[model samples]
Target: MVIPTTSISTDSLTSLASPSPTLDFYDSPEPAFSFLVQRIDSLLDCSSAQKTHHQRRLPSLTSFVRQVYVKCRLSPAILVIALIYIQRLQHELPIDSKGDYDTPHKVFLAAIILACKFNDDSKSRVQSIYQCVSVVYTNIDVNEMERSFLGVVNYDLYVDIKQLCQFIQEHPTLELNWED
Candidate 1:
């Protein structure tokens, strides 16, 4: 449950998190990754001060999630599951005339936390998972987010393996270049 001290440069972060723009999920990680990144980037106002804030600016959601995955030593399938959770949540709470209740970091972290619990053989403690996510979320925030996520998904944590396989088979690129 310890995070390594080695700092991952933002440049390296981009490479790690970069999914192909053409990525079709039928789709899985690609849609979720793009959705999260797009939501976050829209908030950054990156054009305001390009040079000064360039180095110290907060990392993109994609990069941060990549860091969490690496730091927590989570399997790639955790990400896939998290994305599925997100899709289900969207289905439950459609972003329409109703407000956007899903805060970017909280939702993303909660999805990953749930994914870990659902997919991992050795379950990760909430506190330990918080260690990797504390930069963007507090412990209480994580707790609330987990609750919110469970509510959104209707507490249905089970993933259908046949459906997942079919999805991968339908979208060969997701299976082939999942690392992207």
Candidate 2:
């Protein structure tokens, strides 16, 4: 059996080409972009009308995290270490106080040591960091702080630096690029 095939010429196809009505998607009666623009413009207009509106602004995630740490009576450095340690251990450490929580000298030391281990920097040494903490907290005894640091930290000195580096790499918002 023989099959017959029909093919249209390129010239004929070119001749049929004609400009049609150009309808922009954004020009629709209820365009999404237009709604967004209107909402933004409304917000801009209302922004100047009331001071309370500015106060209603949501706290940033970082600020919220810091607030959580503050509530736990943890210094910013300790909070940072806690976060890193938690990530490393894949578990939350008990916040039980063996003694008075008022002077968390041991916790401070532990945090500094943890940070140093994870960071692998000599700048955050236990003694120097403790000294800095002592200066900042004038009432606190440096010897006591050092003792508490040693006591709390004990043998758990090893920290996974690789994990910390990986976490930092993944979270660009952390801004961990510190220059010496």
Candidate 3:
């Protein structure tokens, strides 16, 4: 699969691999389009992703993502990295009942949280992010979700520049908007 857009090239993503606050791509300004949400919706639909049972109805993926996008100050790069992490976790799983571990919200939340921490150098940034997410998931729930995510990937958090480009190339339809 190839990305149809010329704007978001491998070179752009390579630069964003070590994003800084000064870069326009590092901080998410409110999106005018819901591109990431649409891509992720299709991803979960196509992959071996699962959801948990709860008394109350879970929030829609779009809403969940939007809230996280703004509240967590997430960029397209961070969300793309989260997608990479989620796909890696899915690939590592058994594709059976044992793999059906958590709800998509929890999984998504965990991925975003992990991405936030991994992308940023500040402990305060991640801690503040955790506080924002803990309102939806208890601190314990978030911790377990994080641990499960890490364990599935065998504590391998690194996504090299080549590998990241490869992942984007493989899932070209999920083209991230690199421009503001």
Candidate 4:
């Protein structure tokens, strides 16, 4: 499938050049695009040779993320926000050392879902796409994951401009794009 060219329009809930006063998911020259993908893929920690038994059943993390990004037409800001959610959730949730729960994939999924819901204007369309994609997850499973994530994070979904700028500056690659 052809991925539409990304653009930026902060006039809505989103931007193309820099982090606006609020969060937005518009197409812009995403110099940070590849960096964002790499960052999320690294978080999965499941390379082809290192795939856990469960991971083997799913698409490569990079593949899964790209599919979601392209199909959903997600903006770079949404991508950044998803990473933030993942980081926050990692601290709030009690990850199971035994490897039963808190799988990176699940956390990634929930973060993306939350980000999409929070950032997208045509939420119903976005929601419909999520229900269909995201690999083997059913709608109910998606709902539970989202609910669990919100509970753990105390429903803190806000991504302000300063916070976004801070996160970008912290991630050198992203900062480069924002500065350019």
Candidate 5:
């Protein structure tokens, strides 16, 4: 009896590594977006109250800051970095439908991941990004998310640092740089 051996080609491996879906499973807008925004606002109010009250404990202050950060979908440092990235992306890239890519959900996940990478001392790996995306979108496949991420970004366009600096200078009063 002769046994048949099959060899897996590079294309097959690449496909298996990053599976593309017929449609984005995580394309739906988060129903909780508004709720999250409200929650962040409430957290900020609480933090302000704490600041006003000298009796408030240090732990309470720390917790409030953490809660606000989590609710707002940001870290203090990452908020700045993400804003810079967005500003540069907007100036350098044309507003073409073809260039305008990624589902809102995917964009949110990418921003979070990018922010984490820029702000946090510890870097969030691709696996962590996959897990984050998976938690938010239960039905979406991780491989598909990774593939979609690569497809959405236009690497050819260099980020315009000067434009970003000007935008930052002009929008000095904007507290949260990347609200969306």
Candidate 6:
């Protein structure tokens, strides 16, 4: 299937590129983009490995994230925000134990939820958001994941416009290219 590109408006881009506070996502988008790309590669690598019985239910985390992006009808900017939150949560709360499969998926869901809440003007209800994620996870699982995500990220969801504009500039063809 061809994955669709998410578009960002010019007004949003201009505002995002301007200087903003430290909490903004675009304040340091370059590093975050680098980190996001590497982390996604690593996760894809992990998901590609042979699965044991314990990991049977887990879908491909990378593909699943893309699916969430498409199913939620999220803008590319929101996708970037979600990715940033995922990175932040991962950094703050590393998975030291063996059962790591579920954690990443949970974090992804939580990041999507947070991103939608912050970026989308017409908000998606929590239940509906959970419903979109429920295909791969239970409601209870999603709730736990959301709570864990909030705790780890300290509920900071502000993304800078500059970093966002930088990301769009760096990935000019992200929306137009269908190579993924």
Pick the TM-score winner: 4
lDDT of each: 0.54, 0.33, 0.57, 0.60, 0.34, 0.55
Cα lDDT for residue 116, candidate 3? 62
Pairs that collide, model 1: 25-28
Instruction: Give, for candidate 3, the lowest lDDT window spanning 10 residues.
Output: 1-10
Model 2, which residues run further than 4 Å from truth? 1-83, 86-92, 95-109, 117-125, 135-154, 177-180
* TM of each candidate vs. truth: 0.61, 0.31, 0.65, 0.68, 0.37, 0.61
- Give the per-residue lDDT of model 6 (tens digit) for 17-109: 433222323332334334444555444223334455435655566556655655655555656777767657656755552335455566667
Which residue pairs come into collision in candidate 6? Answer: 16-161, 16-162, 17-161, 17-162, 24-160, 25-159, 25-160, 26-160, 26-163
- After superposition, the stretches of candidate 5 with alpha carbons farther than 4 Å from their true spots are 1-73, 92-94, 98-102, 124-133, 138-168, 176-180
- Candidate 5: what lDDT? 0.34
Task: Write model 2 residue lDDT over 1-180, tens digit each, in one string.
Answer: 111111111111121122311111212212222322232222211222223432234233233233323333222223334444434322222333233322222333444445444433444343445454442333255445544454544534343334434554564443333111
Highest lDDT: give the candidate number: 4
Q: Model 2: how far is 146 from its true place, Å? A: 6.9
Over the stretch 1-180, how does candidate 1's per-residue lDDT look in tens digits? 442322211111122233322212342344445654564434322233224332234465577766666667554455555666766776676444232323555567888788766654334544567887665556887888899779877997676554444444564444423222
- Pick by TM-score: 2 or 6, better one: 6
Off by over 4 Å in 6: 1-5, 10-55, 94-99, 125-128, 166-180
Question: What is the number of backbone collisions in each predicted candidate, taken in the order shown?
Answer: 1, 0, 0, 8, 0, 9
The TM-score of predicted model 6 comes to 0.61
**Which pairs, if any, clash in model 2?**
none
Q: Tens digits of per-residue lDDT for model 3 on 7-96?
A: 223333333544422213322333412544544343343334434443134456567677666665555556667777877776776645
- Looking at model 5, the pairs that clash are none
